[model samples]
Target: MKRQVIRSTTLVETLAGVDRQSRFQHRRAFTLMETLAALAILGMVVSSLSASLHLYWKYRSVSRSQITIAQLQRGIIEDLTSDLRMTLQDPVAVRAASMVAAARSESATEKAGSEQFLNVTEQVLELPTDLRNQPVHFIGTSQAMALLHEQRNPRFDQARSSYQSAGLSHIVWWVNSEGSIRLPLFHSGPQLITVAVNASKDRRGLVRKARKDSGGSASSTSDEDEWLVAADVTSLRLRYFDGENWRTEWNSFQQQALPLAVEVCVTIEGGPEQETPVVIWLPQASD
Candidate 1:
């Protein structure tokens, strides 16, 4: 009887222990519905965080691009303003002086002899309107502008005796579609400088070309002659302002005066289309 009672007690204790372990496991483990709910909540949180991070990076990229463009625009404006302000020769005065010189030459030829006078007069009368008219140093159009300006920093090369003095330089700004181009500001000597757009499959930017003469017949492999000003330019437009009104084109030869101001509009590509217009006043014109 005692052995049977002991065996029964042992069996009951073992069963109780098993039941307690099962209850503990059931309490500790999640239900199927609870697991699904927790998984959904976790996914939502992860997605929210991912979206926030993506937005942050996107905004940062756009902001950086905008800042870069803004700095470029500021630089362009400063350069334009400085160049325009330092114009050396007044177109009106230059044209007047040219006219006076021509008149004196004709008078002197007339005094030389009647036969020579007749021949010269006939030649002058038969000359084309373009040739007869005085050429103005300043020429501006909707897309391009050329002017004579004083060099800010003149450099004389001791090694190159042939280099001209940089007291006066000719500057031309235009827009064109070609290859990747960038031109640095060159003040080596009296040079005919041209600024234009260079466009390629990968990049588009402004290019500067400096030549020894206005004819651009001389070519050099020097990197200083050609370089880039800025990149990723979409468009460039130039406008002129007379004393009375704004004009899309200007010719000092025809108008006999310089524009009061010049407006430059540059459009950049990236993020959103950004266009900045900069106006530079001409002190020579005002004078």
Candidate 2:
């Protein structure tokens, strides 16, 4: 009877210890459903954060592009305004000067003698008496414009070191797809301003060419003179306001006067508003 009691007590103690251990393990470990729910919540939080970051970066890029384009547009408008404001509007005098310059350029190219110089003077005197000149210094089209404007001599321009005096300069503004264009004034002759848009797959941009008079001859435009005003320009349109209405074309020689205003629209790639139009009033036109 003593041995039976001792064996029963030992078996009861062992069973109780096993039950306590099982309960402790159940309390320490998580359920499969709880673990899956926690994991799903974590995934959602991470996905939401990633999407927010992506949107932020996308908006940042677009904003930067738009700012750059706006700045470029402002610069273009300012330059056009300055040039048009200083345009030399004396049609007869401009026509005579242009002719003389043309004759001189041709003579220089041929290495002619004093006879060529005399011919330049004679040609200027022989201009037709008609009030409307045949070839005007100011010519404007939808895509391009050329005019005789007085450009201020830069006090310190490394590119235009030869420009000592500020005089009536033949200015041409146009869009060019070609990588680069070099126009030698001597070779171009009377057609000092040539608007050529070559089909190029490399790049497209707005170009400004200026041929300034040095002494009696028109100096050849250097690389600096042929400036790439704006890059990645898809389209450029120029409209002239003649006080009465807006026209796609204007010839000072035919109209015998400058346009009252000019509207320039430039379209560039990678901008919020791909196209921007700037209107510049010509002060000389009012006079």
Each candidate structure's TM-score, on Cα atoms with residue i matched to residue i, is 0.61, 0.67
- Which tens-of-lDDT digit does each residue in 32-92 have in candidate 2? 6688899999999999999999999999998888899888888887878777776777656
Evaluate candidate 1 by giving its C-alpha RMSD to the native, one decimal: 10.2
Q: After superposition, how far is residue 45 of candidate 1 from its true place, in Å?
A: 1.2
For each candidate, the alpha-carbon lDDT, in order, equals 0.57, 0.66
Q: After superposition, how far is residue 104 of candidate 1 from its true place, in Å?
A: 24
User: What does candidate 2 score in Cα RMSD to the true structure?
Assistant: 12.2
Estimate candidate 1's alpha-carbon lDDT, on a 0 to 1 scale. 0.57
Once fitted onto the true fold, the runs of candidate 2 whose alpha carbons sit more than 4 angstroms away are 1-11, 31-39, 91-135, 153-158, 163-165, 179-204, 212-224, 272-274, 285-287
Q: Root-mean-square deviation of each candidate, in angstroms?
A: 10.2, 12.2
Worst ten in a row by lDDT for model 2: 182-191
